[model samples]
Target: MDTKRFISFEGLDYSGKTTQIKRLKEYLEGEGFKVYTIREPGGTKISEKIRRILLDKAHVNMTGRCEIFLYSAARVQLVEEQIIPLLKKGYFILADRYVDSTTAYQGYGRGVDLEMVRLINEAATYGIMPGTTFYLKFLPEQVNKRTKLSGRELDRLEAAGLDFYQRVFQGYEKIAENNKNRFVVIDANQGIEQIHQKIVEVVKKRTLEEL
Candidate 1:
């Protein structure tokens, strides 16, 4: 399937991806475009069930391999049940996270083998990929600080310590470097409006170019 209308946002928790996605969706709709926003591990009914299991703080002992497989399972379901169909209808699909999240969080954070992670991600995505991925870049320390200030309860993965998050951050850096043509690195530390403006600018340019 053509993915020119598929845009994804990636970042650690508290990196403001959800907010940015909401803004982008609103902006797209205001421009008279059909927009669909979905979150990874929990878009379709089946996927949402897997998402609950994956994020439950009670599942602390889940193995890295198991975690990756579960994530891939959810992803494949969302792709087959939701993403592909939305794209076919000419809707601009915005994903909160995608395959790269698995590479960063499961492969790097959990110390899973990179080669194995690559294969699983390829299988789950069925060769479908986002046309543009906006990575909200922020240091692990900054994310931790925001989490503490927010006083929100941490999920299983979010509760992973600073070292784990650091590895994930580094993984994202490597992935972005390797896929420069598809990744757009954005400074997430900026004011919300500032970041939104930058994303809108890039989205506008990309959509126009694709057209």
Candidate 2:
């Protein structure tokens, strides 16, 4: 057992990340691995407060730049308060979302500067990149069908229009272009069982089990 591994799932809003995170957690625990699961912007106590400002429909008027920093700030708190400690205790951290959301939603989707996105996350996060990241590549149209994120159509970033979501998808692909060693681009369009099987393959490859 590697004993130290951090994993995260990244994608656009309504991309089935939360559901998949729950399933993955159950699978890992069943395999007898100590796991800790958390979501960005809403993981820790103080950070959850930040999540409200970032996601509430009433905050729809938030400037793109402001949105970027809020997420970074929340993540910084999450790292210092929660994630790092669990990792230090030799737990496999299963993160629902992370810095990649900023790159996708704020930078590519909302037309913010990608460099600015990188700098903010780099400054805030405590060097906790995942050993493996599963990017659930899904189109906004399909995501909307399943999730239909009620209460608000979508935030500024998500409401940037479908064209922007396409660019965000490309942006995520570009991230994987160079960092292929640590990123796994999965076909999320498949049925959940198929997707789970692919995920299991990756997990088995990275984290072994003697069954």
Candidate 3:
């Protein structure tokens, strides 16, 4: 078995992040690996509280810097209280969204300082970055159409409009480029099964190399 690996899924909303995460988790567990999954900003009690405020659409006035801090706070708690312990027990950690979300959403989407975001995120995670991050790539207009079709009510972040997401989409591109070794960009436009298969292949290949 590969040394307990940390994997994260990153993408814009309605980009099939949740669907693919569930599929991968089930696949790993079926293979007898001790897989542990958690969503960003909400794995622990304290973090979940922070998540509520961050997602609340009514809080439209939330400042960009404040957004960064809240996300970092929630992340720190999840990292300390949940992720580390689970990793120590040999569970493969799969996160729906992680530090990269803050980089893309707040730093790039909200125009906060990217360097500051990276600094705080590194400190929060104690320098623990994902071994592999599967980035589901999509365009902002595509995301808009998908959101409309999904029938899901918009959250505060989603309500920020398409321009914001366009910036975020580009941010993910830069992030993936900057961290080529750690990021695997998947074309989310592919059929669900095709995307999942590509992810599985990457995971299996990396596991062998890393272990």
- In terms of lDDT, which candidate is strongest? 1
Candidate 1, which segments miss by more than 4 Å at Cα? Answer: none
Better of 2 and 3 by lDDT: 3
Which portions of model 2 show Cα errors greater than 4 Å? 1-4, 148-158, 209-211
TM-score of candidate 3 versus the correct structure, residues matched by position: 0.96
| Clash count, predicted structure 2 | 0
Per-candidate TM-scores read: 0.98, 0.89, 0.96
Candidate topping TM-score:
1
Query: Can you tell me which runs of candidate 3 are displaced by over 4 Å?
Result: 1-4
Candidate 3: residue pairs that collide: none
Predictions in order: lDDT: 0.94, 0.79, 0.89
- Tell me how far the alpha carbon of residue 192 in candidate 2 is from the true structure, in angstroms, after superposition: 0.8
Candidate 3: deviation at residue 180, Å?
0.4
Q: What are the per-residue Cα lDDT tens digits for candidate 2 across 3-49?
A: 23688899877777887888888998998888888988778888999
Q: What are the per-residue Cα lDDT tens digits for candidate 1 across 44-65?
A: 9999999999998889999999
Ranking by TM-score: 1, 3, 2
Checking candidate 2 for backbone clashes, the offending pairs are none
What is the per-residue lDDT of model 3 for residues 1-211, given as tens digits with 9 covering 90 to 100? 2322889999988788889988999998998898889998899999999999999988999999999999999999998898888878888899999999999999999999888998999998898778889999988999889987988888888888988998999999999999999999998999899999999999989973556
TM-score of 2: 0.89
